[model samples]
Target: MQVLHLSTSDISGGAAIAAYRLHQGLQHLGVTSQMLVGKKSSDDKTVFAPKSNFSKALGILKPTLDCLPLRFYPGCDITRLSLSLEWLPDRLAPKVAQLTPDILNLHWVCGGFLRIETLAKLNQPIVWTLHDMWAFTGGCHYNQDCDRYTSSCGNCPLLQSGNNWDLSHWVWQRKAKAWQNINLTLVTPSHWLAKCANSSSLFQDRRVEVIPNGLDTEQYKPMDKRLARELLNLPQDKQLILFGAIGATSDSRKGFHQLQLALKHLSQSGWQENTDVVVFGSSKPENSIDLGFRTHYLGYFHDDIALALVYSAANVMIVPSTQEAFGQTASESLACGTPVVCFDSTGLKDIVEHERNGYRAKCFSAEDLANGIAWVLQDGERWQHLSRRAREKVEQEFTLELQSYRYSKLYEEILHFGDREGIKSSN
Candidate 1:
């Protein structure tokens, strides 16, 4: 059966990487799988640059055509919409209408290309992976603190305007009406996200599957610690604690500021000298000021080998996020035999087994975070055991090959059901 995978961006984010990995995984299983991306971002060009300018222009135009509705929602990238119907191009419409792939597996369709109505148009069956909470709610990616989705959402809780597009009505009710007719199934990367999806009005009655995101195990497996550290120029003696903050100073959602605060507390308490906080993106936070912890900045390592080295050299991986769909970095670190620590948030809870694989601190508190870090650092024997277990967990549950196998079987089931249902319903 032919399968078409869709996503907003084809970059290296969790969803993009997940889509690409699934593509590779399906290929391994000898399935005919292809990718359909809304916009070709920078990574797309860098990763798959065309030899000619004509091909480059077409890449640019595909996303640009999705922007015609700016007259209504100016500056909004329609190509990035959630199940967007408004931007579905005539070129794609025919292929979608004709090929009618046995299954269309959608990853992250937020931004604009997919409006809610697009799902209703699909005669083929659909399997949508919930990378975040945006698919269930009115239109927010990460609802930090709001349970309004279980019922009807209005009197906006998370939005700064406290209103949804000047509508007095509940937006989710409208979304529910548009989405209820589709022959679609929901898949979540983490069990926590599955629970959240089940509680939502859109998917409460639907069968929610919890499929953990997979990694390229062979590529991410443990590297030689000494050689990795030497290649990365990291200190061998200091306990290398790796942290990934997307925007070290700007993105509050990442909790970079909170991590800085926790590290500050560690320094004042005389623990900074023994640790190193290596960050992946952007410049180091100036707020880490009095924290005498030696910092190592790897800016950003795009290649898997370099990333594997960073993960292998680190003694432990810290993911102190305020909110996350699923900590991809945590799984990657685990695949590299490095334990991870994060807050006991919804997504993190799925991967961490208390003190087994890693530590999950009290919901987003700096002191609690610091204490968790100290515990992992001081308990060398326990950490080593957890490290081995961490690798085993990834090998067993989170590999690209395994992910492809699971999805291939799921697609076959959906296609068979869709064909049988189509025949029966016609009579």
Candidate 2:
């Protein structure tokens, strides 16, 4: 079987990493596979083809000037992406066609790379993984259930700041038209998301499958916490709280501000003197009453082993994100024997077992979050039990071997189904 996996980035965060792992797994199964991504990090091109300058330029310019009706709306660029649709396929088709894969497996189709129309021209079978709700919705990458995508999306819940054009309705209409024309299978990484897809009008009649994301357990196993702290030169006595992602602190979508407020609440309630926040990708705020000199800010860690150490050293890992397709950080933290604390919402709802492995704060409330933090730190024995369970959870479900095997099976089934349909066509 030949497969072409496409995504936004080559090897950055969870989605891209999963894409690469799936690519390697496909190769192991003796299938010819290739990965195409719009943007490659400085280190990524060493492995995959870096995007051409024209595409990169468009990636920059499209967002800047292509606001057809005005500047900046919820799904503005995404809805208007078809404007550049004609130019991209010609340049990308040869590279994608060169692989001539049996199936085109698309991951994260948003972010201004090959729009849905590009896939229409492909003769091969198409399998798209819904990493987020963007594919089903009119335009918003994440709908948060405003029901705009289901019917006609005129009054978008996520829209903000625009000109006279009420672009949401037009975008939704266009999306419905585009989706009706595409021939593909939809894969959701979580059952919750799959259910959401099935309920939505766009995917109501479409075939949808639930396949969970997999983690690399071998690299993320229980490292000695003390040794990890020692290697990193972190405090032995302080209760380390680790959190990270690509744009962890800066992204409003991450709810880092909420986490900060919760931390401040902890301080106000007299629980912050001993706590230290070890942020991986972004830094802690310099002038904040919630954090003091206790914060350890390690800006942009690329090494896997070092990241593992940070997770291992943490008493708890916090995913304070308001939205997550799948909380990869939570899984990674669990793999390192660190329990995760996240808000009770969306992708995070499935991550923690609510006091079994970790705690989920009542909601996005700062007080609730602080209380959850205090409860974990207060009882060392129970927290230790959770820590062990966290490791066990990853061993059973999130391991790389488990993930690769699952994808191998899924790929085989997709290929066989396509073959059977082709035979029927010939008949």
Candidate 3:
């Protein structure tokens, strides 16, 4: 069967990469999967984007125009978190109609790539994957501690608007109206996000399913630590702790500041001198961050091979995220036989089996994080056991082949049900 996936970019962020991997996985299972992205970065023929220069230039300008509505909310703290407005001039409905896929899989289609009204325009059955809380919320990507989304959102905390009829309310109303008639199903990458979506006013009446992200296991498997270190030119003597992502330290949600506090705690507890920190996706700033130990900043690794090398080189991967939809790096580290250390909260709690595969520290506790790190590294025999289980966790539950098969089944079910009942008509 033919499947079409829509995303903002082909392989830019974690969400984009996840979507692209699923497209590849579907192809491996002999399914015709195509990705139509706003900004195409790869040379994959199956992945299509606007070919004309005019449309490509408009693509570059869409994100800026989409945020123009936020200017009305003058009190907003722009750096607090990300916000998306349902404003864009797009002809994507016709584009999708021309492609004529049996099923439409939507990924991170925000960033001005899709207008809010676009969902209702699609003809085929839709499977929308939530990479963040944007799908259910008023405007902000992560509601954080806000529960206003369960009802109609107004006076948004992120927008800093005090009035009940604020920009967020307008956006929420638009979604509530436009999406009421669509043939859509929601898929979340974690149970925590699934719970959040189920509670949201927009999705409360809709069906929401939990499906964890999957990766290529063979490409991320373990390599010799000594060989990995040598390949990356890292020192062999020091035990390594790795942390990375786009804007790894700068992004507030990533919990880099919390990691700094944990590292300082480790230093005072007598483990500073023996350990070094390795970071990817970000380089050392002009004013370097002091994490109580020497830091090695190996910037972005474009391909999977280099990422695998970095994961293999580390003894432990610390994903100290305050909030995460799903921790991709943690699973990738586990696939490489490197234990992960994350808080026992959000989506991360699902990936690490405490003390069996990895350590799940107390939520938002720097001291507990340090304690967990020491626990993982202090016992050499236990480290091997953790490493073995880490690999096994991904193989049994998160392999690419398994993910493709599950998605295939879901697609079949949607098709069968749509025919028996009524499906949304073509635009």
Candidate 4:
């Protein structure tokens, strides 16, 4: 069966990475899969982009143009939240038709890559994998404690607008109207996100499936810790703690502030002298406040080998996010045989077992986060057991082959249902 995966980019962000990995996984399993992205960073021939320079330029500017309607909400917070009304140019449907795939798989297409009207025009069956809350909500990706999306989104907390007729309501109305009759199936990478989708006003009636993101365990597997540290020039005697995300410091949802607090607690409890912190995905900010430990900012390593090395060099990996769709970093750390410490909340709970392979601190509790970190490092014998289990868990459950097989079954089922329906119609 031919499958076309649509994404905003091929390898730029976490969502793109997950989508690309799935595309690769499908190909590995002998499925014909091609990816169509707004921005193509890889040289993969199957990954297509707009050929014309003007269309490419428009693709880059689409997200900014789509947000122009937000100007109507005078009280809105100008944060990095998404407010996709999906009223942009509908150029993708024709391109999709030209490709003529049996199924269309959409992933993170909210950066003005596809329009709401275009979704209704697609002839093929659609499988939309939601990387965040954007697909169901009125378009603040995380929703951040806002339950308005569970019903009809209005008076959006992210928009800081209290009017029922605000921009969020307009977006919600557009989605409700345009997407009502589309042949679509929903997929979420985490059970937490699936639950959220099931409760959402838009997709509550749709079929929602839970599938965790897959990774290449061979690439992410553990390295010799001493050799990794030696290659990176890290001090041999110091204990290293790792923390990062796409926009580690700036993104409030990543809970870097909580990590800082946790590190401070660790410092007071005699970790100050020996422990050092390593951050990826961002450079050290200009005049940044001290994180209460020696800090190393190794800005964004795109190479998987380099990332695996960094993960290997650390004693433990901490992902103190407020919420995550799948917690890719936690999975990667585990695959690298490094114990992960995250809160017992959201998608993270799926990856981290309390005191099993890693530590799951109390939700939103910095003290508990610090305690978990300390607990992981307190005993070398326990750390070895945790590390061993962490790698084994990924090999058993999160490998690309396992993910591909599950998806293959899902795709077969969807196509079989469509074929049966066609037969019924012919009669």
Candidate 5:
């Protein structure tokens, strides 16, 4: 079977990385898989991009072009929320048709890479792997406590618009008109997201399956703590707590503010003297607020080895996100044999077992988050058990091999169903 995976970018963010890993895993399992991305950063030959200079330039400008409609919503806080009305020029359908794959797998295709109208033009069966809430909602990626998407999106909170005949309604109408008859299947990386998708009016009748993102356990496995710290030039005496994301501090959804509050609570509880903080994916801000501990801001890591070493060097990793489709950071930290502490909500609850491999604190409670951190670090013997279980859990459940096998089975079932329908039509 031939599968072509479409994404906005390769290896750029969590979604991109997850998509690329699945592509690689399929190839490893001897399936014919090719990746087509709007922005290609790696040197992989199978990955394709727009060949023309003008098309490449347009691809870079598509995000901005898609967001131009937001200017009408003067009251909107664009920085705090996301909006994508995918109405820009997208010539991907013709290119995708030329490849002539049996199935087209879509992942994170929002930034004007594929227009709503183009879905009708594609002839092949589609398997859309939703990386966020964008596929079901009108335009906002995260609904943020709004259930408008469950019925029909309008008067969007993200757009700060009160009118029912607003931009969100327009986008929703476009989707309802364009995508009503398309042959599509939905896949989500977490049960929480699948539940959300099933409840959404856009995909309420569609088939949705839950599949967690896969990782190369060999690359993310643990290293010697002392040696990793020595290599990273981290102090050997102090305990390190690691926190990071693409925009660690700026993204409201990441809940960095919650983490900061939890750290402060830990400090007040007498853990401050022995602990320090390490962050990646962000440089120290000019007017950095006191985190109540010494902070090391390692700007960004481009490779997995550097990231794996950083994960190895830390005593524990904290992912204090308010909502996540799948907590990739927590999985990576566990693969590195570092215990994780995260809220017992969203996709995180799938990865962290309360005091088993790691700790899952009460949802949105900083005090519980602080207590979780202390519980993981209080005793070396218990910490060793947590660390061992963390690594074993990834090897058993989150490996690329297991993920690829499950996807392969899903693909086969979809193709078989299509064949049976074709036979009935011929009769």
Candidate 6:
């Protein structure tokens, strides 16, 4: 079966990475897959982007223009402004019509790539893989603690709106009208996200399914710790703790503050001098904050192999995000045979088993996070066992082949049952 995937970028953000991996996996399984992206970074022949200079220029300007409506809400917090308006017109529907595939899989089509009204224009079977709450909410991506999206969104915390008919409500209405009858199916990578989709006012009536994101095992497998440390120039004497993501230090949702608290708590228990922190995705700022232990800021990783080496060298990985659609870094760390320590909440609950492959600390508890870290490193033999189980967990459950097979099956079911009544719940 021929399938086409739509995304903002082919290999940039976490959502695009997940989408690209699935596209590659389907091709590996002999299913013809093609990706149409706003930005194509790799030289992959299967991925296509706008060719004309004008189109390329528009792609660069779309993300800024798509968010132009937010200028009215001057009081809205700028740091939390992840809203996308999708008001700009694009001649993408004609391009999609020309390529005409049996299935259209949408992944992170915002960031000025696709419009809310554009889905109905395609007139094809759609499988939307949601990477965040943007697919359901009025404008904001992560709702934070606000439950306004469960009903009609207004007085959005992200926008700092205080009224019911603000920008958020207007955006929500647009989505409701344009996408009311579109033939679309929803797939979430985590059960937590599936629950959110089912409870949301926008997608409550739509079909929802759960499918975990997959990675290449061979590219992310364990490497010798000493050799990895030697190549990376990290000290082999100190026990290393890993933490990082996009905006690893500045983004509040990633819980860097919570990590700071946990590290301080861990230091009090006689680990201040023995443990060191290794961070990627963020460089050390001019003003560095002390974590009681020495911190090494390795900055961003260029590829999966570089990331795998960091994971393989570390004793444990820490992911303290307040909420995540799916913890991609957590899964990547596990694939490298490293135990992970994360709060027991959100999508991360699916990846880390409690005290099995890794430790799931009490949700948002810094003390528990610190204790979990100590427990994982206290005994060398136990750490080895956890490391073995970590790789095993990824191999048995989150491999690329498994994700490809599941997606192919879902595609067959959607095509065979044109009406698609029985394919309601998850596989």
Taking the tens digit of each residue's C-alpha lDDT, what string does model 3 give over 253-299? 88888898999999888887889989888877898778898889898
Cα lDDT tens digits for candidate 1, 265-367 = 8778877777887777546555654444778878877777788888999988888887777878889999999988888987877787788888888987988
Q: Give the per-residue Cα lDDT of candidate 5 at 380.
A: 94
Error of 3 at 382 (Å): 0.7
Which residue segments of model 3 deviate by more than 4 Å? 419-427
lDDT of 2 by residue, 104-173 (tens): 8888645556655566667676777877777776566666547756766556545543432355666655
Report the error of model 5 at residue 210, Å: 0.9
Candidate 6 or 2, higher lDDT: 6
Error of 3 at 51 (Å): 1.5
Weakest lDDT window of 10 consecutive positions for candidate 4? 418-427
Candidate 4 lDDT over 161-194, as tens digits, reads 8788777887888889898887788878888998
Report clashes for each candidate as comma-separated counts: 16, 0, 0, 0, 0, 0
Q: Give all TM-scores, in the order shown.
A: 0.85, 0.86, 0.97, 0.96, 0.96, 0.97
Candidate 5 lDDT by residue in tens digits, 1-427: 9999999998898899999999999999999999889999989998998878998898989888888889888898766557789998688888898887898899999888989888889888888899889988889888779999997889888877898889998988899899888888888888888889888888887878777888899899999999999988888998899998567667778888889899999998898888999988888889987787899888899888889999999999999998889899899999999999999988888898789989998988988999999999999999999999999989988999998898888788888877222111100
Q: List the residue pairs that clash in candidate 5.
A: none
User: In model 4, which residue pairs have backbone atoms overlapping below 3 Å?
Assistant: none
Candidate 5 lDDT trough over 10 residues, lowest sum? 418-427
Model 6 / residue 411 / CA error / Å: 0.8
Clashing pairs in 6: none
Residue 300, model 2, lDDT: 77
